[model samples]
Target: MNRAERPPATLTELLSRHDCDQALLAALRERRLPELHFYQSGPSVRAWTELCSSSAYRGYARSFALVDAHAQTIASALPDRPIEVVSLGAGDGAKDLRLLRALASTGRRPRYTAIDASYPLLAGACAAAIESGYPARGIRADLLRDAHCREAGRMLDRQRARLCLLLGGNIGAWDPGDTLRLLRRLTEDQDYLLIDAHQFSERDTLPQYDNPTNRRFALAPLRALGLDDSAGDVHFRLGTSATVPGLALVEKCFEFVETSTVSVGGARFAFRRGDSIRMSSSGKFQGHAFALFLESAGFRIRHQFGGQAGGQVLLLAQRRGAGG
Candidate 1:
């Protein structure tokens, strides 16, 4: 079928799609802590919202400025046809709105689709997008799963060009191999991929996770599991690795100060005093390391944008070929 013959994609075809409830219940039944559920709880979501507002998170502003400065170029990269702005882990949809507005200013009004594992977050994002006059949809599916990605992609009008977003240093916390795998799953030939990273060097402030707000955000998951401040203390540590040289790692470890028992799935697990569990970690790449990493993952970096602080880097990449 020719592009002209295809029916126009309507907002109804892309409205709120979710499977988070079943995924969360299954994760809980397995006695495992899923990061996806971390934002599902009220406290975690609030803590994350607060964390985003903190002064240290200047990456958002810097990235937005970069996108705005090059809005025309970015928009020109898209096909002349209809475009779909698909943001993974969209959070409150604020950043996506910024990008969408930038694209609009360049005479492009694309459909916006926010994909997140948390239904509440996705719903809020979709609502905000709709209020802002963008055709919007929300998909509550784990982006890491193959089936979910396939289903999410299938929702797009076949002829529409896709711009997949993975922003806010989200990829920094993921394992390198898994990160590559996710990029591969999310992009197809000619599809655009916008990803951000938090750069780290010896000169940059290294102890960001030491802040109380940072601690609260990272430990929010533990709180959702019924553990409180008294149950443990969250600490930050810096480490280096031989495998990925020039990449600095900041890890958050929650150390139990006393004996604690948490109940899950009608069973209890014991945590001895002084036990330390690594909660989350972010890798800060230096110089051209991030570019090389992307190349290694089979992506060709089309453009690079740096934030004001010189720490937040955004890469506009394209899949190498159809298989990618």
Candidate 2:
């Protein structure tokens, strides 16, 4: 298909195939929702929006010099040409607008493509971009799957430089190796991956993830299938990966304070009073750990931005060629 005809799939059309109910039941078998469905529905989306907009999350970003990095340094580093900005798990797309505006200020014409599984969030991201006067497309696909990744990559306007954004600590939601393999399919030799990561701190991270607001967000998927927090309690604990040492994380687990049975789409799951299921794990890097983490993932760090105490980071990395 020609560039004009590609990405013809509207947000609604893409969302039609992304069945949250079916995904939820499949994920229940594992007693956990992968990052793909961890935050999957309208309620979940709204809850996450609330958490991100909360003073704690926003305040942390502000105190860490992230705003300046996004506006000036990060945008200034992009190639001076037409660019196609693609963001995965884009959420509300709030993090993208600043860099988009900064690119525009530099006399660069850039378009946007928001790839997310949530209909409400994806639509908002696309509408915001169009209202802001940038051409945009919304693709509802799970970035965790290889086929979905390549197909979404093809739907974009390939003539321009492809700059992919996995912002707002979304990559930390999944295993780093899995994320690296997923991103490699979405990018090519010259394409760029602009990613965000957070530093670990109980004092700093606890307030962000340990609150009731975040608990609601994490339990949203279960609530969609006739289960609620009343069936269990959400707990946050520091986690470490057996594979990667010195990696700190805030692991959210839902412990069944009362026995619960969930039935959805002709499938039923039973849980005992003492049974528990993992909700999600968000990774936090130590100082300079995120850079080395990305480098080891086969992405050569071209330019790095935003690394204050327990702050958010945006790194511009290029896919390393063979032996690079």
Model 1, span 152-255: residue lDDT tens: 76776567778888876777666666667766766777788888887775645455567777778888877776787888887767776456655677766778
Question: Which residue pairs show backbone clashes in model 1?
Answer: none
Model 1, residue 162: distance off in Å is: 1.1
Per residue, candidate 2 scores C-alpha lDDT tens digits across 1-324 of 345544432563444443656766777887876766655667777777677667656533542246455666767777889888888888778767776888888877888888988777888888787777777878887777777777876787878887888877776778877788778878887788888788776578768887777777788777877786679888888877666545687888888888888887778899889888887698888788888887877788988776765777778898887756
TM-score of each: 0.84, 0.89
Worst 10 residues of 1 by lDDT: 8-17
Off by over 4 Å in 1: 1-34, 203-205, 241-245, 307-310, 322-324
Query: Model 2 — which ten-residue stretch has the worst lDDT?
Result: 59-68
- Candidate lDDT values, in order: 0.71, 0.75
